[model samples]
Target: MEEPQGFFSTGDGCVGDTVTERCLVESKEPVSHVQLACGLCFCAFPLDGNELCVWSTKDPSYQPLILRGHRQPITAVTFGNTVSPLLICSASQDYVMLWSLDECRQKVLLASPLLSLLVDEKSKQLVAGCADGQLWVFSLVERHHYRCVTRVDLKKKRETFSRRVESRLCSLPEENRRPRAHGLEKGEDMEGSLPVLSLAPCDLSLLLSSECGCLPSESAPCLWVGSSAGLLILNLANFELEGVLRYKDFRSLSIQVAGSCAMMSKAGEQKAICLLTSMFGCQIAVLEIRLAALMRSRQDLGAGRSLSVLPRGCVLSTSPLHFRIAEEHRTPPAPQRRTVQDQPLVFHSKVRSSGYATAPHVTMFSPKTNTRNNGDSPSRRRSSHRWCVTNLHFSYSFYAGDGRWLACGLANHLSLVFRADLTGTPAVFSGHDGAVSTVCWSHDGRWLLSASLDGTPRVWSLRRAELVLCVGRDLFPKPIQSAQFYYLDAFILCSSGPELQLLKCHIDTSKDEIRRYKQKSRCRPVFRLPTAGPTEITSLSAVNDFYSYLVLTAGRDKTVEVFDLNAGRSAAVIAEAHSRPVHQICQNKGSSFTTQQYQVYNLFATTATGDGIKLWDLRTLRCERRFEGHPNHGYPCGIAFSPCGRYVASGAEDRHAYVYELGSSTFSHRLAGHTDTVAGVAFSPSAPQLATTTLDGKLQLFVAE
Candidate 1:
């Protein structure tokens, strides 16, 4: 008998290593606690057998390094964020132990039970929140000089700040007095203080300067401490409370988790930060605070001056404390249920429904020029040679303004234009030297625009299937991600890396070889709008519906920003729109070329990996609904709204297209046809037709019977 060529050899000892590695992860005891460090580099857990297992998250198949020293039940285990010599810290009833993975050495510190632990790499400090309403700061400046720097009694600070605030309020007139401030309960001063639950650092480097009118130094980081009563901002340098933020509406909230994220500012001199707090009672609050106000509060709390309240105007806006729950929608009874694959995708074109063969030549209005010399020559279609699908690439495709044509960008340095029904031969436009990434059509359906990774954008004359204008490579510093006809085709809009340019282009199809390189010089940038934080734009969307002025862009930093072209500035920003980078965004551009109501433009949808498609109202800047049921974790699947705006469609990793009613969270139809991950989806504006493309270079079309 012959051995299989791909089979592993047991004589090489591979089978024994595999068995040993598999058994190492198996334990008779269950894991009681688990904790993961900040970048998810390391994970630590305490087994029920009183043993601590520290494992590398990057490679979990290997045997975990185990440490056994704690005698009492481990209350908490944390991993430090240091790059080298992974630091593992654990707390017990007696003390806290720090284990260095590199040296295999252990250091012990006497302390009380800790609820939360944070290791600050910049300051070389270990900060812990104790169960006794206190904060312990340990300095690790040197191996031998490690010692407790200071301990803050949170309960004492809260009481003293409360009394100082009450005394100041007592001096006001009776009519001016309102409900007890800070959401404090009646006779709360007589009760005990709230226990500290969490601690996080607030880096002042996110802002330009500190409150004392000087740049933020390396040692001037702030600490945000969360407790049952409220949240307190403390100056880590002196361990003094700077400001307190309490929700007046939710007096019973016990804040357990606190976090912060920086916001992009229009002006480089000032920025803002959003402080987020989650309480035990299913309540969460998001407060946007300006850096100027925050630094001013720090100045007001100097050694000689004392103010316990947050500085006025520091908080730009505060969302009401509430929990977000996906609305469950009950599907209504229908006349008849239809399967998703009821209609089959027919391949109407014989030549892969893509490009033609010959290249068009340009001359200075010469009568000897042959009219059939364009790439759409009929003789080439009958030849033995044909365009290979192996080199073709499809990034995006869309329906024409009149719904009669479909344009698709290809990686083979060409774009294909065909009928919407996938019938008839596609008109091929070839000029780009790199893969074409984006395709846009003029509102009148006379001209088409395309962009490619070759760092140039070209305009094609649809009637002649010839390139009229092309931009130069030197104009853009990076490859163009997207380009389209904006403002009724009066100007061109393109996003190249982190910058968006609005250009006034003059179309010149004069193919005189002498002026061939002059087309790029005809276009000049009118506005250069860079995204906040200089984040690279992943997706761009703008409707040419009667020259709409709003341009929306999604950045790699998980932010959706709307630029007001009329105002020449960023109008609004939706920060942290999703947990990951937003890859697809679509506005409800109806099939009709006429401008519809403003509400139609206001409703847009955004999709990120793993996160479901979110419907947002531009006017309110809030998520109106979330449509899920499709798995899109590994790929940046495309999303689009139906022409009527009644339904939304998305491609998923499960090789199917999901269609959901706008008012419902559950999927209404699961269209199955593709064999690979569906990466792009588009709905026809003129008819009830849908098109989907897969990652493996396959296109499918579905039409309502």
Candidate 2:
């Protein structure tokens, strides 16, 4: 046989295809460095040793490319004026390089060390501190060239003197010009009017030096010097002493002045000098020149008058060399909330229905209505009642007439019946040698049917709580998997090893004997339905009506088969409907009907290998939809549809009961009070309540909103 078009070959035969294909491309390089930036601390790492990798904080695994370079380890990164084009300056200890990165590629420019670096619109400058303690001025000379200019030398001397004394009489004081015996005057106006200082290289007139450690200005005619004893402000234009600032026991390391003093420049402005000890301690001292004194000085020099400096403002001390201040602000506006208005509402019913009527001797309105409403007010009752039954692991359960009684089948071949009247203790009926697999109540509420792994079906009287009859292997000569009562005639569908046998049931109430209503010789095989490859039938449920009479069966084939019960033969099949062998099949209440209007109905639902619940439409013989959000590790063992047809509850091997909404077609929520795999789920007929039993032998009741 040619393989199905979309199916892939597997060890377990053909299955439906659901995976999508994808491809990935990788670069041929190794990653080197990683860094995180921004005020929010987002992570940015290097990929391929050349590309910048960026990823969100929440998801660090998926790294996307932000920028790629031709060379590796783009060092010296800085965020420029714009957030983009984060300026990255890299040097290989041999070549100095500059790169402007936008998003993907790094643009390399200015690959030389002699070039000066320009401060962009971001107001940040790069000052080179050489090993000789000399500062180099770097500014943009052109669009691409940065001119480097060497500024000052601290080793240069201002004046030199010879050690020869000219004359001892010349050191005499001016007040006493007459020479004394020792040739020394008492009051001395000696030291012959301080010697003039001159530059060594006269051609380098632009070069300036200070007596103490002072800063040379680019546009000022005065150089300010600072030493351990005092501060010296000297006129560069006239080579004269201008002003002296005194401080005790402190030395200055750096001086920053506002403007010139000799020339008509912006003077009288606040000048700041940063003082530092040899031990790397710093202090800031400020000097403000009076505007009146500055104006008079300019007038004395025969220069045009102008307000060189504004009035002094508040002076600050001990400011850092590179200081940054940030103002605290409020958080940004929240994003507009997005509402998922069209998402379907999932209605979940608890394991048992609350407000179930507890009246005795109540009758159902009609066989077709399936309504058992009593005159009791729904608000007057507690949602559910708690019961204590030890080791009561139930695999199947049914609620009879007006929710007055409940029957449960257990894996230990024990059956339990709980009276809703809450007046008496529950009764246990045990007879089968193997696990009881199914239980159901007759329409008239007189007989209860139970099928077991012991290959027998038993009938019990509800009032006496006693086993009435046992239909064993002698009747069908095979393992009976499921049995149900249909009004006067009981419909028993059995799995005889691998074949399906349908038998009609009859009860001789006078002798209290139950037997196969049809003669053994006349009873023939109705139809032999297909299994899940080689798996046997595991479960079955019969619909309530005639024409479209359906028998839903689950098998180890991972498929749920819907047989045409009235056709007397299994003709159509839904193959491979589940990912694995299905454990149970259940018909929704009110799903079985014969009507003139052709209404579509989701007849039955099944639970299988995966944590998935599938809905089957009987009329089309197709699997309509699936609910897939259950715990993936669990094996779904039993399923039950709520009487309201709005929700489906399932029990799994993970010891949890999962409730799924039929309208939303999704698993809504999970109930986690069970200690072992939940084996059965049954809802109250009159209200939204549920009863659940687990393999650990605990029974629980739950209410739904």
Candidate 3:
């Protein structure tokens, strides 16, 4: 069978009978788990009517086998050995069913609510671990049906019935027999509490039991069981305990034998592999068992000793993320496109500790963005308390004139609104269909410019609380990366993906209409600067000297290119600006230095990681000096030079924000307050106050102390 390759496609089923609709597939329910065995792929999901559905790996068409014996949900399933008469076993709350894949019939092997199922060492028998703290052994030799021939009481087997003239605890050395106060006591009964969580087959269990008199001369394979107490290797032959791998605080939730994936040396000696999932955390430990160490060990097996097996590696589950540069949401020609009012998402603040300063707590409040009101901060008047009025990003945040209003673009396709005091407000702008990448403010602070991955650029008027204009995809085929309004909003200079475009807009404040137009008036690009750039520009900053201006764009390739709008060509390119990807570039928001009369621009560039900030002289087309001391993080640091151009502040991934003296380029004191990454930091335009935005959606304020 061929492995399914390429990226997984997602969409609704097609309608037409044409060739383009042939590959469209649909599912009524979501798949819970996927399994592959003997070159056949199986997807398992609980059916609507107390049934379990198993579907095969065929695209555009599906065939499922309905298994309906269990009254409860099916918790686990596994395939049988590679021998003749293939079998599949399922474990649920009611009983364990052993079914023949060829015959399509099954019989209850045991009347036990099982948690895990596995084939024994010889592959001729099955080992079922139940929630009743018992191990049931069943033989698959019968032609008609398998029967549970024996059962092992896990608690009794762990009691350590010694063959020699010595008590189990007294048999160990004086130092090794020390009592453990945390674990279970000798008389404590854990009968109903200790449920079998995970199970596997191991040969080492048999080898260890052979040395101790606990070995039984029976004919069954060995089974490894994992419980809340620790890991135990059981000799299924005579229902005796063999070996143990102990971990006190963590309980095992799932187990898998990586024996097939074991690494071997030139001498043909193979390493044993085991993967165990923790019940409390999303951590999976990969332990490499050495049979040599177990065979030649001195620890007494009579008094259950902890096997010194450390994890060779670990597998941590990562949060899944979905983002796009821009999604083309084309409006159908007339009478189709409609207005969409997005549902309000509960806004939260201060999810983590305040590291540096303690501000007044914004008791419990409902907000569209992460903004919460505290003390006497004003609140918006929204009739529906269940839904917030204004709503909710990263370095995507920008301050509008004197920092009266603040906007943050986020990955959730929403922008947050906050006042200069970092308090709650109801004036949030939301219409983007994709992740908001960058936001800019008009110099006068009246208009707000925002570009998103949805290939749409919108202009918002703060005074009017309305969406002024939207630059449609008809004028922008690619997503806009970064956008900045020229001096007074004459032409919006935008990083139109790999190139640049000067989109023109008219200030029509006279029309204060509360409506979404299906088809807005289309405007063409007045100026275009095309550079078949190697990568999409992630950061853009435009500096207009009151005439034919210049825009600097930082690409993923770690190169910065200066585009002269007058010449309509690339002026200067700065290579190796940083060791890693530069995500932010800030030109002095105030003006160039008066000392350098000929120079027009001085910019601060920050990379995703590596050394600190880099200052560039656009006149010389080279780096002046790098500002070190601040640590780099994954998210682009919210970097900004103070209005006076005396200091610079940038957010850090480590829940801290860094301050630097622009002249000395040395590290200053850090604003330490926040539990998560400080995503955006900006200095107040009017005062000496600093504002910070965190990933958890809180806007923090700090005074220069």
Query: What are the lDDT scores of the predictions, listed in order?
Result: 0.60, 0.43, 0.53
lDDT of 1 by residue, 616-687 (tens): 766445455666558776677888876656678888888888876664445556777678877777776555
TM-score for each candidate, following the candidate numbering: 0.50, 0.42, 0.44
Model 3 C-alpha lDDT versus the unseen true structure = 0.53
List candidate 3 segments past 4 Å from native.
Answer: 1-401, 512-522, 544-548, 591-601
The clash count for each model shown is 0, 14, 10
TM-score order, best first, reads 1, 3, 2
TM-score of 3: 0.44
Per-residue accuracy of model 3 over 415-473 as CA lDDT, tens digit each: 65556554445466789998887776666566677888898888887766677788877
Q: Whose lDDT is higher: candidate 1's or candidate 2's?
A: 1
Better of 1 and 2 by TM-score: 1
What's the true lDDT of residue 484 in model 1? 82
Report the number of the highest-TM-score candidate: 1
Give the CA lDDT, 0 to 100, for residue 665 in model 2.
36
